[model samples]
Target: MIQVVLLGSGNVATHLYQAFQKTSEVEVIQVFTRNQSLDFPSTIQVHSYNQLIPADVYIISVTDLAIAEVSKSIPFENQLVVHTSGTSALDVLDTKNRRGVFYPLQTFSKVKKVDFSEIPLCLETEFEEDYAIIEKMALSISKVVQSVSSDQRKALHVAAVFSCNFVNHLYQIGSEICEENNIPFSILFPLIKETAAKIETLTPIEAQTGPAIRRDEKTISKHLDFLQDKNQKEIYQLLTQSIQNVKKL
Candidate 1:
């Protein structure tokens, strides 16, 4: 059995805490947090840094900013140390001679339900033996574990910002446009879903259907007049022109 001490009781930490408890092969030996929590069963007490006990692994599921400082606080005897951060590296865990990165790519929120099996874990470490331990720990929770190097993981993270974070911001803009037009955002739900569905089977260039790609000047003129904000008009114009220049346009 793999005994573990979980540091930080945030969203990711909470998910790992509950899920790991459910697995027969893993046991949560202790939970460490600065504040008291009623969510955990009373039998399983919360702990401070000094109260942390011996375990096979110490998983720090804290925020990116607090990781290095928290690493310094932990008094483990150079046991396996891993952090659940995407951008942060193995070097953040300064305490141990052995360190690794256990980054779950999927976003975590307390009320949101997530399937652990579908979550892709990016694992990395300086020491090869420590890498194996973190890899097993990741596989215990997820089937989609990838042993990615630090550089590749960083590149994937940059791409994720454009896909996930930037796309979410665009969704917010679309919702705002609907609000200004006195139309419910739900009307665009089907279109939004269809756009995502198309990309699975077809290349983005093939699935590209827009006034810009069609070079329908009449529709483009109408859209430009309808756009009240200069910023929105410019973005729409730029994207449309890019589509028009493509050979497939």
Candidate 2:
């Protein structure tokens, strides 16, 4: 069995711990966290950062800013250490230990139950030998495993922010507009799902439709005029212009 000591008690850390618990080939030796009230299996031992125990692998699932600080605090040397970050480079970990990244390319929420097997695991290692160990752990929980370099991972992270984070923000804006008109946001759910489903078989450009793509000046102007909030109006104009620009290419 692969032994692991997981650091942090946030969404990623908690999800990893729960996923690892269900895998027969992995054992979480201990979990280190600053939040004493964080919930976990009663069978598992939880400790603070200063009381970290020895394990075959130490997984740092802390915030991006805290990654370096947390990894540097680990007293061990030359041991396999990995962080769950998308944008941060693998070298952010102290050179005292073997460094790597175990980035799961999916949004995680504490209240949401995630299907580990469906999440894509992006792996990177400073040393070649460490890759297999991390890959094995990844495969134990997930079916989709990929080897991503630091540079490539950074690029992927930027794309993800645009695709996932930005798109979600747009959804929030849509909901806000719907609420303002006494329209149930649920009315748009089917269109939203259908639009997303179309991308499964068609490129985003091919899937593109509506007034923005068609460059219907009248419709675009109507939308801008309807939006009272300056921020919303600005976003709508910017995105509409972006769509027109893409079509021009």
Candidate 3:
């Protein structure tokens, strides 16, 4: 079994620990956390930052800003330490230990149960030998494992923000608009699902539809005028222009 020590008690760490527990090929030796919000199996050990025990791999699933500080706190040197960050570079981990990144390309929530087999695991390590070890651990739970560099991972992270976070915010705006019109936001559920489903087979450019792509200025103007919120109007205009520009290119 691949013995592992987990740091941080956030969504990612908690989900990872849960997944690892279900898999027979990997074992979470200990979890180091300042907050005790998560409930782990009775067999697993939980320690504070300074009381970490020796393990084959130390997975730091902390925030990007805390990664360096957390890595420096580890009492051991030359041990394999990896962080679960998409934006931070691999070098952010203290050089006193072998550094790597084990970024899962999905937004995690404590309440949501993640299917490890579907989630893409992005792995990078300083030493080639370490890659094999990390890969083995990642593959134990996830089927999609790829070697992604720090720069490439950062780009992927930005794209994810655009596709996931930003798109979700747009949904919130749409819901607000629906609410103002006394329309049930649930009425748009099918449309939202179809929009997402289309991208599965069609390129986003090919899946593009509606007034913005068609350059229906009258309809676009109507939407802008209908939106009483200045911010919503601005966003509509900006997105319409952006769509038109992309078509031109």
Candidate 4:
């Protein structure tokens, strides 16, 4: 079994711990957190860096800013240490130990249980030998594992923000508009699902619709006039122009 130590109490850490439990090939031997955590069993929870045990891999799944700090605190050297950050470079980890990245390309929420097999695991390592170890661990839980470089990971993270985070914010805005107009937000569920489903078979440019794509100025003006929120109006105008600009390409 591949012994593992997870060093964070956040969503990624929690979900990773759960996923590892279901696989017989990997075992999360211990978890190190800054505070006493309710997520993992207390028996394996260590709050001090000195209490960390020897493991095949140590995953620092903390905030990007704290990754270096946590890595430096580890009392050992020359062991494999990786971080679960999509945007952070592999060098962010302290050089005392072997450095690597095990970024899962998905938005994690504590409330939502994700299928580990479906999530893409982006792996990178400073040493070529370390890649096989990381890949073996990744393949234990996920089918989609790829060796992504730092530059490629950065670009992938930005694209994910645009596709997932920004789109979710627009859904919130749509929900608020529906609520204010006394319409059921659930009514948009089918449309939202269909919009997402279209991209599976059609490129976004080919699937594009709405007044902005058609250059219907009257409809665009009607939307801008209907929206009372200044921020919403600005966002609508900006997105409308952005759509037209893309169409010109």
- Each candidate's lDDT (Cα)? 0.81, 0.91, 0.90, 0.95
Off by over 4 Å in 1: 42-47, 241-249
lDDT of 2 at 96: 93
Please give the distance, in angstroms, between residue 147's alpha carbon in candidate 4 and its true position after superposition. Answer: 0.9
By lDDT: ranked, best first = 4, 2, 3, 1
How far in Å is the alpha carbon of 186 misplaced in model 1?
Answer: 1.7
Tens digits of per-residue lDDT, candidate 2, 130-234, equal 999999999999999999999999999999999999999999999999999999999999999999999999999999998998878999999889999999999
Candidate 2 shows a clash count of 0
Model 4 lDDT-worst window of ten = 240-249
RMSD of each: 2.4, 1.4, 1.4, 1.0
Candidate 4: residue 39 Cα off by (Å): 1.4
Residue pairs with clashing backbones, model 2: none
lDDT of 1 by residue, 134-243 (tens): 77777888889999877788888888897788777778888989999899999999999999999999988899897887889999999999999898888788877877
| Candidate 3 residue spans exceeding 4 A from truth | 42-47
How far residue 120's Cα lies from its native spot in candidate 3, in Å, is 0.3
The candidate scoring highest on lDDT is: 4
TM-score for all models, in order of appearance: 0.87, 0.96, 0.96, 0.98
Q: How close is candidate 2 to the true structure, as a TM-score?
A: 0.96
Cα lDDT tens digits, model 3, 1-28, are: 8899988888999989888988888899
Q: Each candidate: how many clashes? A: 0, 0, 0, 0
lDDT (0-100) at residue 83 of candidate 3? 99
Where model 4 places Cα greater than 4 Å from the true spot, the runs are: none
> Of the pair 3 and 4, which is ahead by TM-score?
4
